[model samples]
Target: MNVAVSIDARTALLFSPCRLAGLDLRSRIVMAPMTRCMAEDGVPGPATASYYARRAAADVGLIMSEGIGVDHPAALGEGTFGERNMPVLQGAAAIAGWRAVTDAVHAAGGLIFAQLWHQGPLRRPGSGPQPRAVSCRPDGRWGPLDGSTSAPPDYLEAVRPPTVAMTDNDIADVIAAFGRSAAHAQTAGFDGIALHGAHGYLIDSFLWPETNSRVDAWGRTLAARTRFAVAVIEAVRAAAPALPVAFRYSQWKLQDYDARLVDTPDMLAALLAPLVDAGVDLFDVSTRVFHRPAFAGSPLSLAGWTRRLTGVPAIAVGGVGLSRELKDSLMAVVPAEDNVARAVVAIERGEFDLLGVGRALLADPDWARKLRQGAPLPAFSPAAFATLI
Candidate 1:
C-alpha cells in the first residue's frame, strides 16, 4: 500500500481553523485524553509537561489533558486507584504543576483543555476511609480503562471493593470540588475545561441506569439521572464563564459495552437537553469505532448526531487512524489506513466537527503534522507508552 505525504482534498479542510463557542483552535485535530499515570504526590512533573508539549509542538489542534481529579473526597486517591499516580487540580503544588503544563502547551503553539474528573463508584478499596458510590453497587473484580473503552484490564480499578451509597452531602461536596477544579484550570491558563462525564466515572455512573438505581431525586427517571451531570456542567460554567465547556460522553460502559444511555436517538437528544441548556459548548462523543453508524438507520456517528441535535461542535473519536482501538493489553495498537479515509469522508459530509486521534497520537506525535505535510506515518507500538516519545 502506497501512502503519500501530501494533504488530500478530503482532509485539507480539517486543517483549517475552527472555533467552538469561545475557544479557538488552529485545526480540527483534537488529541484525545489518554492517562499516562506519570504524576506523583498529586502533582504533574516536568516529564508530564514534556510529553504533552511534544504533541503541541507537532501541531495538534487541541489537546485534552489526561483526566485530573478534583479536590473532592471521593476523587482519585487513598481509596480509589492507588495502583497508579494521577495528577490533581487542588493544592498549591498541584496548581503550579499543571500551570507548567498549560504554559508548555501554549509555548508550543497549541491549546489545551483540563478534564475535571471524579472517581465515583470506581474507587479502589482501602485507598480512603470508605468506598462510596451512586448506589451500593460493587465494581466487581475488574473494570475497563475508562467509561467508554471496551478494551480491558481495568486500567487501575481497585480489586472488588464494596462501595457505600453516596449521601446528599457527599454529592454536594463532589460537585463543589468540580467547580473549584474549573477555577483552578482557568488560573492555570487552560483555554477551556472538559468535564469527564463519560466512561464509568462518577458523572457517568450517575447518568447510567445500571450503576444508578437510586429512588431519590438523583435517580429513577431520565431527568433525575442527568441531574448530577447537569449540576457539574452548571457549576463549571459558573466558575469559568468565559471558558468553553466541553463534555465527553459515551453510551457504552466498561462494565457493559452494550449499555445505552438512551437506546434511541430521540432519547439521546432528550438526555442531552439539560446539559446543553446548562452551558456545554461542545460534545466530545467517544465511540469504539469512529465511522460506525451510531443508530439503526442513519450513517451518522455519535458525534454526528450530537452536532445535528444540539447545534454545537462535536468531536468524533475512536480508531481515527488505527485498525483497532487497541489490539489487547499486550499488543495495544495496530495500523489501519482505511480508518483515516473513513474519517475524511465523514468530515467532508459534515458528520462531525473535530476529529480526535487517540492511540495514534500516543504512538506517533507527528501524526497530524505529517498528514498535513504529506509525509508517511509510522506504525504504532505499545512501547511508546514506556517513554515521553
Candidate 2:
C-alpha cells in the first residue's frame, strides 16, 4: 500500500486504461524490469513476490518481472554479484514460485509480464558454465561510446571471457527454451511475456554487428542477425497464441552506448518490419534518456520511430524519474519533478504507449502515489538500493 493519490490533473493522465498488443492494462505506468537477483537456485522466493506485490498495490500498471532466466545453459549463466538470486524459471519450483508472484500482483489489480533473459558473452567467468554467444567476442567489445575512459568496468566487463558460439542444436535449444518458458508464464497466470533483447545481452549481442561476427544465417546482415530473435519470438507465439509478446530492443548496447543496429531510418524500417512480421505485438524500446532524439535532427526518440515504423504499441524507458542515463543510474541521485512531467507530456503526445519508471520506483516503491500527491521524493541512495532485493 501507498498513500492515496488525490487524482489531480497530472496523475490522471497516467492512470487511464490503455490496450497494449491486445492485453489491456489499468494504467500507463509500467514497472521497468530491475534485476533484484534474489532468487535462490533460479526460483523466485517469497520476498520476490512481496517485492513486486508492493509496487503492484501502489498502482504500477504493469510489472515486467526481473530478467527471468531461460532454460538455456548460458542464460545469464552466472548470476549477479557472485550470487544466483536472479530468478531462473527453468524448473517446477521456479514455475511455482513465479505463480505466487503473479497471483499476488493480480490480487492487487495489476498486470505482470515475465521478461525472458540470456546474457551471452556478458556472462561472468566464475558463473559456472561458460556463456554461449552469437560470436566469440569478449565483453566490452565495442567499449564506452563516450570519449571518456576513466569509468571503471562493471561486473559484465570484469573477469569475463570470450563466449563460444552456439552450435546448430544449441541455437535450436535456446529458442525452444524461450517457448517453453512462455508457455509456463501463461500457465502461471501472467498476462504476457517480453524477450530481453536489449542492453547487449544475449539477444542484443546477436543484433549488434560488433558482437555478432557469425557468417551463417544467424548473422552477416541485419535480417540475418534478427533470425535468432525471430525464431525465439515465433516459438513464444506458438507456445502461447493468446499471450501478448512484447519485444524489448535498442539501437545502442551496454557494450557501446553509441552502437547502431542500422544507419538510416530506411535501415531501421528494414530491421523492425521483419521482426514485427515474426510475431512481436509490442515493443519496449530502451534508451539512456527518453527525451534525446534517437537519430540526429529528429525529435522522435527510439520508441517514437518504432511506433512510426511499426504502428505497433511501444513503451519508452530511460531517466523518466531520476534523470540518469542507463549507465549513470548506478549512482545515487535525486528525482526531479519537471523531468517526470516532461515524460508524461511525451506520452500525451503519443510518442510511446507507456512510460517505465526505474530508479524512482527503486528508490521508493510508492513513487507513483507520491508523484500524484505532489509529495517530495526521497533521494535514491545506496542504502535504499540495498533494500531492493
Candidate 3:
C-alpha cells in the first residue's frame, strides 16, 4: 500500500490533539501497557524510565506503564511466561524507581498512567516476592480449565488444585492494598491510575462467574460482584483525587480464551454502570480485534458499547497496528498496514476515543510520529520483545 495514500485516507482527526480526563494529549494514539517482566525484584530501574521516555519523546499521546503489582503480599507471582520479575508500586526502592520514570516521561513532554494489577488465583503458588503468601481465590477455586486456551500443560496442572477462598478480611486487605498503591503512585509522580480489572486477574476473578461462585454479597449477583471493583475505584479516587482513573475489562482471560463477562449489551451496561458511578474517568475495553462487534445484535464494538452505555471515554485496544491478535505466534513477522487503516475508520465513526498500539510501539517507539509523517512503518518481530527498545 502506498504510504501517502494511506495517510490521505486516514482522517487528520486521529492525529489531532485531544483531552481525556482533564489531561491534554497530543493525539488519540495510546501506548497500551504490555508486561515485559524485566524489573529485578519488582523494582523498576533506569532502563524502565528510558524505555517510556523514548515513546513520550515520539508522538505517542499517552502511555500506560506495564502492570505494577498493588501493595498486597500475594498481588503478584509466577504466571504464564513467568512473572517473577513483575514490577510493583510499593516499597521505598519501587517508589523511587517509578519517580524517575514519571520524571523522564514528563521531561519528554508525555503523559503516563500506572496500571495497578493483582494476579489472584492466576498467581502461581510458592512464588513472587512473598512466596509463603497463599494465592487469593474468589471462591477457593481456579477458573475452569476445560476451555480454549494458549497456556501450557504444566501451568494448568500447577493451578488446578483448589485453594482457600477470600474471607471478608482478605477482601478488605486487597482493597486497602489498592488504596495504598494509589497513594504510592501519587507520591511517585504518576499522572493517573489504570486498574487491571481484566484478563482473569484478582479483581477480574471476582467479577467473573466461573471463578467467583460465592453465595455471599461479594458474588451473589452481577451487580453485587461489582462491589469489589467499586470499592477499589472509590479507594483510588480518594487516594488520588486529582488524578484520573481508568478501568480495563475484557471478555477473555489468559486461563480461558473464550471467557465471556456478559452475553448481551444490557448485561454489559449493568456490569459497568456501578463502576462508572463509583468514579471511573475512562474505560479501557480489551478485545482481540478492535473492529469486531461486541454483541450479537449491534454493530458497535466493545469500546463503542461501553461509551454509549456509560457515557465515558473508552480506549479500544488489540491488534490496532498489527495484523495478528496477541495470542497468535510472537515469532511470526506481523504486518502493520491493514489493521491501522481499520483503526482510522473506527475512530472516524466514533467507535472509540483512543487507539492503543502494543507490539507495534514495542517494535518502534516512533510509530506515532512515523504514522503522522507518512513514513514507512517497520514490521513487528519477536526480537522487539527481548528488550525495552
My TM-score estimates for the predictions, one after another, are 0.90, 0.89, 0.97
Candidate 2 overall Cα lDDT vs. reference? 0.75
Tens-digit lDDT track of model 2 for 1-389: 12222344865788777776786778788889888867767788888888888888887988888888777666765543454567777668988999999999989888899999877666665464333334223223433445322234666466344445677777788889898889989888888988898877778777878777788888888899888889989999999888888989887765456777777778889888888999888899887787788788788888889999999888898877664464544554544434666667777888888888777788788877676667766555545556753
Candidate 3, run of 10 with poorest lDDT: 1-10
Predicted model with the maximum TM-score:
3
How do all the candidates rank in terms of lDDT, highest first? Answer: 3, 1, 2
Better of 1 and 2 by lDDT: 1
Worst 10 residues of 2 by lDDT: 131-140
Superposition TM-score, candidate 3 onto the true structure = 0.97
To one decimal, what is the Cα RMSD in angstroms of model 3 from the true structure? 1.6
Tens-digit per-residue lDDT, 284-303, candidate 3: 99988887899987788999
Q: Which is the winner by lDDT between candidate 1 and candidate 3? A: 3
- Sort by TM-score, top down from the best: 3, 1, 2
Residue 96 error, candidate 1, Å: 0.9
Candidate 2, residue 208: how far the Cα is off, in Å: 0.6
Each prediction's RMSD to truth: 3.6, 3.6, 1.6
- Whole-structure CA lDDT of model 3: 0.88
